[model samples]
Target: MSAVASWPVVLSHGPVTLRPWRLTDRGAWDEIRRRNASWTGPWDSTRPHDSPEPPLTFAGMVRQFNRRARHGGMLPFAVDYRGPGERRGVLAGQLTISGITHGSAGWAQAGYWVDQRWAGRGIIPVALALASDYCFFTLRLHRMEVAIRPENARSLRVVEKLGFRYEGVRQRYMHVDGDWRDHAMFALHVEEVGPGLLARLEDQP
Candidate 1:
């Protein structure tokens, strides 16, 4: 019963848009990462010292994302925001739906990061809601989860605003900032957001 979309899918709401990452995005992505290195490093995932996975270049990363997307394993989106009077959107961040499982499992997890310049503007929540609705309705996934470092208060608020329930914590769950770090798990089921996640977000005061 697994459902996956064709590659290069795009989702949008108001000023925010989620689209496939492009090779041309290398420059902007690199610049943002450079400026925000200190801002995002503490919570960002890091390869374990003992692991054999090679580091990925920007092009390599985009290629891998596209390959996984074609295989229905992941949705790697480059977040864009089109502000007033701008002819085009600018890359503002990234949101990825990874670890998708079908059949009885029917679940997936989402992870995201925004440029420091875009933080505190509610863009991540919009991007998250768009992605979650796509999973719940279009992909027919049963559950969606977000794992956050307990210290990431900003990320915690995004899930709270969307009404995802706090499930529990996973100790030493993932390698982050050079070591295995604990994560507080939060989740939402399709039944819980009956209308749709995006709709729920819009209805929020």
Candidate 2:
């Protein structure tokens, strides 16, 4: 049986629901990859370099999702809308806990991507808000960090809209496109978590 065989893992506001990635999601996931190929190619690390195509099978995605789920270090979920029958959105994201240390710096890094079509729909902010809350409250984590390419203005806005503070810059932090690129570090601590996040979408114009 799969780790997420049990239903309804985590709940959040909006039609957006975070649940275990299902095998049925393969088709939609592939469509998303295909649609966003050009938009996501530069920043997405999972995109294969050799093949100008999406993964041949969902088995690879299933294996990757299941491994992270069981590993406990990371919990990956398929972002969908709660409608008539689990209608999936164009966006998918995950929360990763790494280098977990006790007392202080018990932090996890968060990374996410959205279908370009859903870019300005405020989906990413809500997802980030809920995920951050889970990290601070449910996971009992001290901090959550997001490392983004300095050139990614949209991503910077997402983190900033959520009230994350700019920490510093890491040179050659992440490999984007092909070469290692500099990244701007942003973080939010447990104490910083509050009701303010609930109003994030409302603040959007």
Judged by whole-model lDDT over C-alpha atoms, candidate 1 comes out at 0.93
> Model 1 reaches what TM-score against the true structure?
0.97
C-alpha RMSD of candidate 1? 1.3
Model 1 — which ten-residue stretch has the worst lDDT?
1-10
Report the lDDT tens digits of candidate 1 across residue range 73-98. Answer: 99999999987789799999999999
Alpha-carbon error at 184 in model 1, in Å? Answer: 0.1
Show where candidate 1 strays beyond 4 Å. none
Pairs clashing in candidate 2?
none
- Residues 123-166, model 2: lDDT tens digits: 77777777666656666777888999888888888998888999
How much lDDT does each candidate structure score?
0.93, 0.69
TM-score of candidate 2 relative to the true fold: 0.79
